[model samples]
Target: MKMKNIKLIGIGLVGAILMIGCTDLDEELNDSVNEAAGFSASDLLAGAYSSMRELQHEQDILASYVHSSDELIAPTRGADWDDAGAWRDHHLHSWTNTHPHIDKTWRDLNSRAFNAQLVLCNGDASATEIAEATFLRTLSDFFTLDLFGVVPRRACNEDLLQPPTQQLGRAEAIDVFISEMEAVLNDMPTANGPITATQNAGRMLLAKLYLNKAVYKATGQDGVAQPGPYTFDPVDMTMAINHLNEITGYSLEDDYFSSFTPTNTETSTEIIFVSENELGGATGNIRNRWHMTMHYNQQPSGWNGFVATADLYNLFEDGDVRRSTDIPGLTDAFGYNAGFLVGQQQGPSDKTLTSLIDLEDRPGNPLVFTEEVDIFSSNERNGIRVIKYLPNLELSADADGISFSNDDAPGNDYVFFRYADARLMKAEAILRGGTDTNGESALAIINELRTSRNASMLPAVTESDILDERSRELYWEGWRRNDQIRFNTFLGTWQAKADASPERALLMPIPAEALATNPNLTQNSGY
Candidate 1:
């Protein structure tokens, strides 16, 4: 099959496809878009955001490696996990030369990027719409780099039409992403012509670029998880720090939970970038899996699948308030019925249940104990249900309509980059190779996140701690595998998971199609 660069279609065209009345082009001059000329720019943007949701779903499956050990998946029907679960297959055992999501994700990201490029390259996209679109594209490339290390950097739709060459290696792709990001951020049009809109102030594209510089700049050829030829550049660190510090008019919400509810999107200060979800709009159910695990009984609970890992739960400190955010036993927020409860099955069983407090009851329930049951493996319930992205209010959580109610799903803007993440990256940089010329060390920066959460026992600010904090704060948001590789942990063993297999699982064995298309594209080290 020929690789179709579908994203090359311009905004006017793509918009026309998704929305019925959004086209600005005249039918005579552009008869191709005449059918879709009625589509709105916002609707076109919504279609682009759908791709974002797809990418997040793929990443979330991989992030489960944190607690997917024997302690977690054994009991839950995740038994077929090897064939059924994402962890046992794609991540844990490294089933190279077969997994298809890797390619699908790239294809989705490419499509999203192409759509954004279309908007920028064609039609009269308003400044706000263009800014949002570019932010989305930058995000797509940023994640693409994170996953593949080095990917083909194509900004123009025209670039995709050309016959492909060898897929670029990790280092080359890093440079490309950096250059593209620099261009994207600089070209980020204001929310308005002269005056920036307050609603658009918190976009996270720039901050994420700065946060991942060290990983991006560090080059490596081998895929089995050893330090590569890439050298860490302090100048890159400085530039990253500068970009991070430059984002203005955003602050952390004192109540961490405030940053996630549908209503919070409008007033939350922590949101750096949000994919606006209008009430009753499309693509609103992206977070159903997480919410269903905790709210299935409260009216439909919307339960289908997905849960949290014990490793992440263990990351919470004694007095840390964040734990209550989704712990085993807490109560409703205000008067609502939300919080942890105990007495739930960890996995499926042939035996009959004497109590209602089985797995069924456990859904939408919280923990009363400190321990998480390993349901998938032991047939015992051993993990906490995730509640992070579920909108706090019932209407916001309702499955009846699209995820974001016409951008009305409260204003819990998705935090692509925020001060906490920035500070953590700075800390990691220091631990890796940063200096204290400004009187700050990796330890100091790490403590900021710890202290803010009122964490009493802090780990020594080292490379390990930095990586650990990243897992704790940025888990499902996507960054686990990259951190594992850069810190040299991918090949090592951890929890119920390990890299003891025979082949290299390093750089997702160059996507199957790419290998068939380009001879220069060799498989990553271990595959």
Candidate 2:
């Protein structure tokens, strides 16, 4: 990676002078102090990074992508998590422009893009700084494009007071994202460590963009109410494979749980890009993955929110290590095993944990999570909870006890991109008729991953097999929505979701607020 030498100009000084001239004595004094101590580009970069963290973990954003997918659902459990049916709307594919999560996510991504642009305009930014800022902007833009089917555009030099009217459509957004990523590829650092912005991270993003380009380019489904076949261009798959090959520094972690431990930032060899988080400080909300899923009586008590569908839980073969339900007798530094939590759960002291919230029928029995859920209104302990990201046991208040603070964020860095995803993407590309360069067949890649995860290797792989493999490997990691979309399974009927048209529900409706603010914004066809 090449670093550009750049010098900070007097923009800070000019701004300070303007503030002092326009404000009272206290404001002038504050400006005077700031002018003496020069503005830091590093601070700007940190802000850009924080924006990415917020975008990834915001409640609405997470719900839009994760809850809408088949792998996870925030079902209405007794008196909890109904949120006036907002959470249920996601899985049912009934989300509207007024959906709070949808609106907040759109606003957050747009704000992040603007903030990154401001950082890029800071004359002190080195080539490395510029590349990182560009990456952040592009990432937010990519999300905006992916979720809304349009990318809102605003130049740093443009007037902030004047609302942004310029927008890029799906195909145009894809092109811009790809081009911007390519421009920063050489300047971005390679992933030798846990840095957030890297060349390989950029490559992963590019591969994803290329892999989904065909879906972005699809047409003629406007106003349609059912999901139909969409053509996948071989060129897009080839591009996806080419970009995947460029990311060579990362390898799969032998233990599938290693990539998701509370200390994953320091321990996992698989994480390529992550939202760096800390115990006492703010960065990532990795805790939500646990806090949202676990029962209220569980050690390190959780909100008793989202849970895995029984159908998804049943997909895992018996004895598959990935499906291991072992609850460690004692909570280690790493916490419990990765995967779904069913049957009787134990506390930190290895005692059978009972639910504080009782069910309608089984009120006094131990809180045994069952695979079967009522869908409309489940008992407090009805659904199987997911603990895919190991709970943060190190932060527990006592060795024999587990303590969790609702306000405190987890220490684990949430992985945004990892080696396993790249491997799977490469395999999918090959299966879709992409040319293989490294002499590794699609079956070889799939079997390698499967075997490493303690599952039997398949003799052959099919498209359905690949989709199932993806669900097994990547469930609850926030890729399910995209995977389901690509597999044409987004609109398929599941536990609570009825069969719907992909054209109607695949893309989220543009938030009504966004449309009101920006006249240029147009709602998706069904909305």
Candidate 3:
């Protein structure tokens, strides 16, 4: 395959069977995404990559992670977002096994695993294809274990007719994934850049697994587990540092949001893994970030759902580029700055920037986002909105539609892993007892990124400082729940979910549908 520099290349695929849950009613688990007899491995591989857009949009899987964490919320604005009381359940950690998002997320994640393995199953997969497939499968399996406990496992050439009996538990699954990812890391392409599975991306993925190995070890495969002060062994920490060390030739972006803009694939130095979005179409869902938060009256009007909690917004100090910035053409043209959006929002250069109306609570007012928000009820403009994945204002707006809809833009590649995160992970690994691979103290290493973002130097560093720093730099990128769990602060009360959070809440329960479909899957503790 020709090296794809930055385009999120789309492989025309005969998409596969969704693999409803971890189990299959018939023989083929994650049944043939392509029902036809003959299919190319490349097509299956593209399906695997394309499906990863689910991770980009803050919905379903990412929604569960964000709504559960302290960083973001999906508060019911009167009657607007109160669907199934889903967001409320996630915020309160009062979700049941049958929660809709939980079931859907589980299915979506396993589907990725099944699709990747599908590529491997196809006899024609090249070495590069096999390497990428292996990485995707492990990535899917990794999240499955992290969010749930056990992941479905099947041997190569295993009977498609029999009910399979191998489901690896947390520790066992983690070990298997680590071994498998390491097994293929070196074979991954080095020249594909961050848009595909490259050696550097493999390294970053392995580092993540290793950093959380202690937690995986604590959360056994049979599934009952809680949040922890889990012993981050020096060996695991060292392995994380070592893998991160292998990821070379990348650095933090001078402008923090540069890592997230439309040209990120070509411009950002920090990206380690990203999805290729359309240059002209909205097939890519990166546009969801902006539309999900900004109010209807704001330029490129949004759904006015998903808002950031103040706790996360308060973490940044003055002059931190990560906090907010104005994208030259986009921000000036559309009236909203690109980071933590608070106070009054603005409209595009139309006859007049739109105004608030029909919102009974505050009609005829500007589209102002209030710092305060309510979960059960709030005016339309409540809580600060975020715009990490900036809109592509260059796309021609619909003459009749609200500035731009899905068709207007989606060129921004969805960022997965990045260099800044790797640096932070190494610093955290050292703080947890590993030797400093960067030859700098954890404080100095963190300060390097801090100074790059124009944030003031920290006088010192602590575990709390690390957690806050991660929040400031990586907010709304969909890793908060993982960070909070690792730091043992997941259960801490924040703006939304008050009262003591149950430790079992650290790991969501296996979807009831999954438990019913696959007996091998066991529920986590306290569910």
How many Å off is the CA of 347 in candidate 1? 19
Candidate 1: residue 397 Cα off by (Å): 15
TM-score for each model = 0.71, 0.86, 0.91
Model 3 reaches what TM-score against the true structure? 0.91
Error of 3 at 259 (Å): 1.6
Stretches > 4 Å off in candidate 3: 1-37, 161-163, 349-362, 395-402, 405-409
Q: What's the distance in Å from true for residue 249, model 2?
A: 2.3
All candidates in order of TM-score, best leading? 3, 2, 1
Instruction: Give lDDT tens digits, candidate 1, residues 100-155.
Output: 65655555555556555555554667766676566666666666556655444333
Quote model 1's TM-score. Answer: 0.71
Error of 3 at 68 (Å): 0.9
For residues 1-527, write the lDDT of model 2, one tens digit per residue.
Answer: 11222222332332222211222344544554344236567766666566566655636456877788887777787777878888888888888889988877776777667656666777888887788888888877777777777776765555433445567887667788888888888888765465568888888888998888777776444322224355667888888898899887667787777787657867787888876666566646667777788777665677888889877898888777778745453233223445877876654434223222322223666777888776578877788888777765543454354454423666677778899999999999888877767777899999999987878899999988998998898888878888888888888788767666456687788877667656666678878
Per-residue lDDT over 1-527 for candidate 3, one digit per residue giving the tens place of the 0 to 100 score: 32322222222121112233333334342234325224577766776787776666555556767788898888888779999898788888988988888877777777667667878888889988999999988887788888877787666576543323688888788888899998888889898787799999999999999999988888643566656888999998999999999899998888788887777888899999876776665345677888888887666667888899999999988778888888776666667677888876665545333432222123666667877998889888788999888776643444554444343456788888899999999999999999764686899989998999899898999999999999998898878888988999888899976787877887888887766756656678888
RMSD of each: 8.4, 6.2, 3.7
The best candidate by lDDT is 3
Predicted structure with the largest TM-score when compared to the true one: 3
